[model samples]
Each structure stands twice: as C-alpha cells, then as structure tokens.
Target chain A: MKKGIFSGLIAVTAIMLIGVIMLTSSANIKNSGSENIAQGIWEIKKEWNNARYLLDKATTDALADSANTGPCTFALDAAKVQHYYMDTIAHIPGCTQAFTVAATAQAGNYQATGTITCSKKISNDFSIKKFEKPAVFTKTVSVQKDMPAAGDCTVIITDAQSGLVEISRVV
Target chain B: MYGENKTGKGFVFSTDAALGIIVVLIAAASMTMLYAPDSSWQKIFQSTSRSMADSAVVGFYMNKVPADMGLETEIPAAVKQGYCGRIYDYNADNGAPGIQSAPMDRNYCGGI
Candidate 1:
C-alpha cells in the first residue's frame, strides 16, 4: 500500500511538471510573436524616417538652386522613389522577414503626401492555426510649405486605422 | 497489533495522495489564470500600434521638406500633371476631412 501511494505521487508530480512546461512554452510563443511584430513595425518606422531625411536634403538642394530659374517644379522620379523604398528595406534590420514595404507619393499645390505600407504573413511554427491573416501597416504623410524658400515645413502623418500620429511645422 | 494499524495507515496514505493531487490541480489552475492571453496581446498590440503610428507621423514630417520642395513650382500646373501622387485633394471647402487644414491652427501642436 505504501509503495502504491509513492508511485501515484510520483506520477502526479511528473504530470504536473509537464503541465508547467507546456504553460511556459505557450506563454513564450505568444510573447515571441508580439515582440517580433513590434520590432518589425519599429524598424519600418526608422527606415521611413531615414528616407524622409534624405528626401528633405534633396529638396533643400533643389530649393537652393530654385532662385536661378523661373517658377519651376521638380519631383523625384517614380523609379527613384522605388529605389529609396528598396534601399530602406534592405537596410532595416529584420524588416524583410517580417514584412514588405511599398511607398507612394502624391504632389499637390503646396503640399505632398507619401504613403508607406508594410505587410506580412501570419503563421505558426507547429500547428495550423485558424483565422490567420496578413497584417498590414499603412502610414501616410502630408507635407506643406507656406513660402517658396527653405524653412519650416508642416507635416502630418496618419495611419489608416489610427487617426493621427504626428503633426508638426518644424524644419 | 501490526495488522490492526495497517488499515489505518492505508487510509492516511490514501488521504495524503488525494490532497497532493488537489494541490497540484490548484497550482495548475492558478498558473493558467495568472497569465491571460488576451491581456498580454492587448498590451502588446496597443503599444506596437501606437509606436508605428507615431513613427509614421514623424517620418512623413521629416521627409516633407523634399516632398514640399518637390511640389514647389513658379508656374501652376494642372492637378493631374502635379508631382508625387496627390493623396488628399484640398479645396476651399472643408480642406481634407481627416488632416488639419493648411495654415495649421493654434492647437496643431497639442496631441501627437
């Protein structure tokens, strides 16, 4: 009888240990997914910021030389914008694994808008999960200048789902 | 005397085993309840989304110089021929629903 009791206790303890391991594993998996998504989004944001800085520099150069010419407008070629998009993706850490980035630009009277979209596939390593869908991050920026000369620029950035993220008129 | 106490010993052992099982089950239940998946995911999603949104805003603004400068022209051109693909079409009336109208107001710098 004593032997039987010891055996049962051992079995129960082993089972409990397995339960704890499984619980911890599930938590780790979920946490990993969350961290990856967050990290990807952050990398995209950083790359986008870098591209914007480059665009600003290019625009400043163009504006500085604008005084020589009579009312003339210049825009980056679509291919050039595409090039920047590709370069940004290559440079951003872990972006390629997480999502693909696409950018579109639109020019208006005194303002221009740049839109960036990052998309990814949702999947699990072990099992086939249901309700799996692609996750996307679509961001847009509208930049406007009051005067012709180089100075402060008004910028507004927004996400399709989220209304507005940043709004400032600084150089 | 020994045989008489054997039965009582068996009873005590059985009771101990039952209590041990219950304790294990309670521990398991508590562990499961402590880490709710919904709350964990919710916290992560909110934080990540907010960060992404903030980054988009700042990125757009930083790149605006070139975009605005690229749009600058001495001579006005047709909207169709304008530079960059125009996302928002601003008019005298209600200037672009979501965004703050051009010539930002006093409260423009309030919330991120």
Candidate 2:
C-alpha cells in the first residue's frame, strides 16, 4: 500500500523537475533569439552608415571632374554625378539607394546640391509588426559648398529633388 | 533507523526520494551536454562582430584626414590593439593601387 503512494510521489517529483528544466530552457531560447535580433539591427545600422559615406564620396569625386562643371552661367554636369553615385553604391550591400543632383544659376552665383538616400526595413517578430514599412535616409551634396574654387563656377542646390536634377529638365 | 521508517506505513520513502534525485540529475546533465557546443559558436560570432566593427572604424579614420594632408592615421591605443590588418589606398580614378601596407606597431607608439 505504502509502496504505491511513495512511487506516485517520486513520479510527481520527477515530472515537476522536468517541467522546471523545460521552462528554463525555453526562456533561454527566447532570450538568445532576441539577442540575434539586436545583432541584425546593428548590422543594418553599419550598412546604412557605409552607404551614406560612399554616396558623399562619389559626389565629391564627380564634382572634381573638370569636364562638366563651369562658370555661373554654364550648367554643371548632373549626369556624371549620378553615374558616380550609382557606381559607389554597388560596393555596399543592403542599400538599394537613390539620389538627386541639381544645379541652379542666380544672382551671378551658381549653387548645386545632390542628395542620396539609403534605407532598410529593421524589423523582427516584435517591434515593427507591420507587413510593410519604410526605413528612410536622405543626404545632400552641393558642388559649390564643398569646392570654394567653384566660386564663379558654382552651382548650389537644396533638397533639389525636382529641379535641374531630372534628366528631362529643358535647357 | 529514522530514515528507514519514512513515508511511514510500510514503504521506505528514502528509496523513492533517491530515485527522484537520480531522474532530475540525468535530465540536467543531458541538457547541459546538448547546449555546450552552441555556446561556443556564440562566442565566435561575438568576436567576429567586434572585429568587423573595429575594421569599420579604421576605414572611417582613413577618410577623415586633414584637408592639407592626403591621409592621417592616429588610431587610439584601444582600437590599435584590436587591429592587425592591411590598408589599401586607391586613387579615385580607380587606377592601380598606389599604397598597400599593414600598419606597424612602431608607428603608433609600439606596445601592440
């Protein structure tokens, strides 16, 4: 009689121990999963920063090209800058990027600006629950601002997304 | 004698208690064996992350030179110790590489 009761007690105790062990392990698994998500976010941040740097470098390089940039009246070459930007982006991953370059002449001074954006969705099972969301970035470069030598040859631009940047702009 | 009487009526509770402890220990040991290799991989991944981050900072430094000088390198000791990689400097024209060399410890005050 007593043997049956003691055996039942032992079984119950063993089962309880197993329950505690499984619970602890599952909790650990979830914690490590969250850690992985954190690392993924870091990788994305690094990639975006890299994208911004390359875009800026590409703009500077194109502006240095003497073939297209000239005096206040003469327009700067937006096409060359776009080419450099696209070429620079190919080196980095996860940043399918975009850019805009515009040159304007006014008051006997020329100013030009180019903007590049690198963005990505940073989501996990938590945080960003939406199926589709946008992570955005935008940067601008001005030919005259960085190159003081472009004085009379200067072109200035701001968020010039719709201006002289578009290839379809009429002369 | 005292333990020999436990769970009292006719059965000795000591045997049952021992059996329960054995079950618990077996489960615990087996679980640890399953997780040991996983923890080692996690360490490798963590070190790789740190190394990549260090490399990125070095690249950032290479670009941030004084306007007058073509390049400036003044890596902090903390970052220097973690880095032992070569740097390659290229012309924007994307021509043949002009300078490619590993940083010497002597250049940064020598300890590392």
Candidate 3:
C-alpha cells in the first residue's frame, strides 16, 4: 500500500510540473505576440504621420516658390504641385515606393486639397506578418494669398495652415 | 514481515516530504510568473506608442500658421501638460526630418 502511494505521488508531481511549464510557456508566447502587434501598429502610425508632414512641406514649398515668381497668381499648377509632393515623399526613408497624389486648387481662395495613397509592410522575424493595405488620406491647406483686385501681379502666399481631413484604412 | 513494514513506513515518509517540496516549489514559481515585470513594460510601451500618434494629430491642427509667419509654433499648454511625453522635431544628426517621435517618458524618448 505504501509503495502504491509513493508511485502515485511521483506521478502527480510530474504531471503538475508539466502543466505549470506549459501554462507559463503559453503565456510568455502570448505576451510576446501582443508586444509585436503593438510595435507594428505604432510603426504604421508613425509612417502615416511622416507622410502627411512631407506632403504639407511640399505643398508649402510649391506655394512659396510660385509666390516668389508671381505675387497675385491664384492659379496653381496642380500637376507640378503633385509632382513636387510625391517627390518629397519618395525621398523619405521607408517610403521609396511610388505613391499617388491628386491635388486641386480653388480659383479665388488659398485652399488646395490633395488625396494621398501609400503602402507599408509590417514584418516579423519568422515572416512578413502584416501588410498594410494601401490607405488614403486627404489633405487640405489654407494659404494666406494676397491677390490684387485688377492687375497682373505676383501673388503673396504665406502663413499656410494645413492638416489631414480624413483617413481611411482598408485593412 | 517486521523488516518489510519498517521500509514501507520510511518510504511513505520520504514520498510525503518530496510531494510537499514539489508543491511549494510549483506555487512559488507560479506566483513569480504571474507578477513578472515584462507585462508592465509592455503596457508602458503600448501607451507611449499610442500617445505619439495622438500628439502628431494634435500638433498638426495646432500649428496652423507657418513658422515663417513668426506665430507661436508651440503646441497648446494643455496638450503638453496632458501628454507624458514631449513632441520635438525629429531633426537628430541621423534622424529623419519632418518626423516626430511619439510621447513617452524621458528614457523612452531618448531612444527615439
């Protein structure tokens, strides 16, 4: 009877140890996965923010350059502005891929609107874990433009205010 | 029979002692794992990252006037105080320009 009890005790102890090990291992794995997900999401968010900043800078630069040449010209070359904006984004690290930007400028006001589409990839040590689907964000800016009432003169564009209007993520 | 009985008694005592030790050890280890520091670190990191995104959005809206306009370029005082991290331009020697690091404690912000 004593021998039987000893054997039973050993068996139970072994089972308990195994259970504990398994539980702790699983918990650690889960914690690590959550950390990775958080890191990935953070990276994506930072990238989006950087992209928006670049777009704003590009737009401002284009406006400034145009103002330097012509003081009261309300007509902005949408294609040229878009080209400069995309070029700025391309120069940013991790944003080497092609991005599309559509821009429109109002005839009278100092407002320009743009839509940006960009892609990002999130990878892990084992594999490419997540691929951010191309997302679209709209940008709108109001520049302080000094237009003449009735004369062919240069437009004074300054004191720009810009921000993202909307952002939609497919995935 | 008497000798066999003595050995059996000894065996039972040793087994009981071993079981007691195992149980104590398992309990201690389980408690330690439950209170591990990694979880806290993970929470801090998550919060810092999220705060960074929030700061970016807020900064964009706040800094409407261009810097050349000589307007106050600083963020709102309420936002700065509310955030646990700082929002400085990412113009480090080797850092990317036009990007801002997320809000985090001083140590975490240093790394960024």
Candidate 4:
C-alpha cells in the first residue's frame, strides 16, 4: 500500500512541474510583444526629429536674406530619406521591418511644425497596436543672416502615446 | 510497534516529498518569468527618440538665419531663373514667370 501511494504522489508532482513551466513560457511571450511596441514608438520619434531638422535649415535660409519674397524652402530628396531610413535599421536590434516617413511642414511666427507619418513593417505578432499616431517634436533656434556660424538649437520630442523621452540638442 | 509505525511514517514522508517538489517547481518557474535576460527596452527607445528630437532642435536654429537674412523672399534673379528650369522669357512673351522649384520646407507660404 505504501509503495502504491508513493508512486501516485510522484506522478502528480511531475504534472505540476510541467504546468508551471508552461505558465512561465506564456508570460515571457507576452513580455516580448510589449517590448516590440515600445521600440517601434521610439524608432518613429527619431525619424520625425530628422525631418524637423531639415525644416529648420529651410527656415534659416528663408530668414537669412531680407529681400526674398517667399520663405526659403527645401525639398526632401530621395537620398536624404533613404539614408536616414536605412541607417536606423542597424540600430534597432532584432528589427525586421523598414520605416517610412512623410512630412508636411507648417511654419509659424518663430516655429515650424512638421507633421510626419512614420510606419514600420513588422510581422503581425510583433506589429504595433495602431499604425497611425502623431509624433510631435519642437525645435528652438536662433538664426543670424550675416553670420554663417552654426546657431544654438534644442529639440523636444513628445508622442501622444509614449509621452516625452528625451530632449537632444544639436551636437 | 515497528510495523504499526512504519505505515504511518511512510505515508507522511511520501506526502511531504510530493508537496516539496510542487513548491520547488513553482519557485523555479516564477524566477524564470520574473528574471531572465537583462534588457532595457526603455533605454533603447529613449535613444531613438533623442535622435528625432535632436533633428528638430537643429532645424529650428538654422531656420532663424534665413528668416533674419530677409532671404525668405529675396531669391537672386539667377536663382529664380534656375528655379524656373526653362530659360526666362525676357521678351514680352510670358505674362507671369512661374517658379519651377518652390520651397518644400517653407511651412508658412507667406515669408517667415
């Protein structure tokens, strides 16, 4: 009788151990998914900020000369976009999809807003919850027309979903 | 006396062994779930976000130079012609000379 009872207890313990392993694996999978989402948001923020820089250069060129009729405008060439998009791929570890960015500039008194739409291509499981989200960034710049010196600038990055991460100044 | 106690002690020992195995398994799984690889997703994301923000910071600064220079509207006649692409019709040929390459970054159409 004792021998039979001991064997039964051992079998039950084996089953319980397997169950614990299964539960742990499931949690790990979920964690991986959340990490992907966070990384996606960060990647988009970086691209949008690059677009903002181009807009700033255009603004500076516009104000540099006093006699021009319209603001100085610069078009985003294919090379610029391709260079930035490709460079980021190396930085995002385990990232499979390439990102695309489009910008529409809105110039104000001393500030110019660039509305950027950045998309990432990833597998269904790892893809972000929503594709379209606004990533807003602001830059403060002081421009001097006579001086060809690189002026002081600061950028603020914020997203509707991810919140503020960091403020980087021009290096 | 030995025979009687053998059965009771054996039963208790087997039960204790079963319970201990279950507890250890749970603890092992919990540790694996809670702690494994040390990866900082926040830091990775922050770095990317910083790159984007930095671009805007520089752009804003560079924009002021053009706005201050009054070059916002003052394109050199040669630059304007080059922007037009085709040769400028100096003769009373074309009524309005259309600018070919307009500024894409100039958000405010009205000079900054």
Best by lDDT: 2
Candidate 4's docking class is: incorrect
Between candidates 1 and 3, the lDDT winner: 3
Model 1 residue A15 CA deviation (Å) reads: 4.6
lDDT of 3 by residue, A81-113 (tens): 666655666544454323344443533334444
Off by over 4 Å in 3: A63-75, A96-171, B1-5, B8-108
DockQ of each: 0.03, 0.16, 0.09, 0.02
**Candidate 1: residue A110 Cα off by (Å):** 23
For candidate 1, the TM-score of chain A alone relative to the native chain A: 0.41
- Model 2 alpha-carbon drift over 4 Å, by segment: A1-6, A66-74, A104-171, B1-10, B14-17, B35-37, B40-55, B58-112
Residue-by-residue lDDT tens digits, candidate 4, B34-106 = 6543255544544443443343334334654333423323334543121100001111111121211122333
Please, what is the TM-score per model?
0.33, 0.54, 0.51, 0.34
Worst 10 residues of 2 chain A by lDDT: A162-171
The lDDT of each candidate is: 0.39, 0.45, 0.45, 0.37
Could you arrange the candidates by lDDT from highest to lowest? 2, 3, 1, 4
Residue-wise lDDT of candidate 1 within A1-171, one digit each (tens)? 445766476566759785776778688668867765655444444444443433322222222222212223333233443343344334333333223334444332112234433333333323222221234434444555657686444444444335544333233
Off by over 4 Å in 4: A1-3, A62-114, A122-171, B1-112
Clashing pairs in 3: A70-A154, A70-A155, A71-A154, A71-A155, A72-A154, A72-A155
The candidate with the higher TM-score, 1 or 2, is 2
Q: Candidate 1: which docking quality band?
A: incorrect
* Distance from true location, Cα of A43 in model 1, Å: 5.0
lDDT of 2 by residue, B1-112 (tens): 2356544543546555776678788977798566433475555655654554545445544653222222224433653233222222223333111111111111111112
What's the best-to-worst order under TM-score? 2, 3, 4, 1
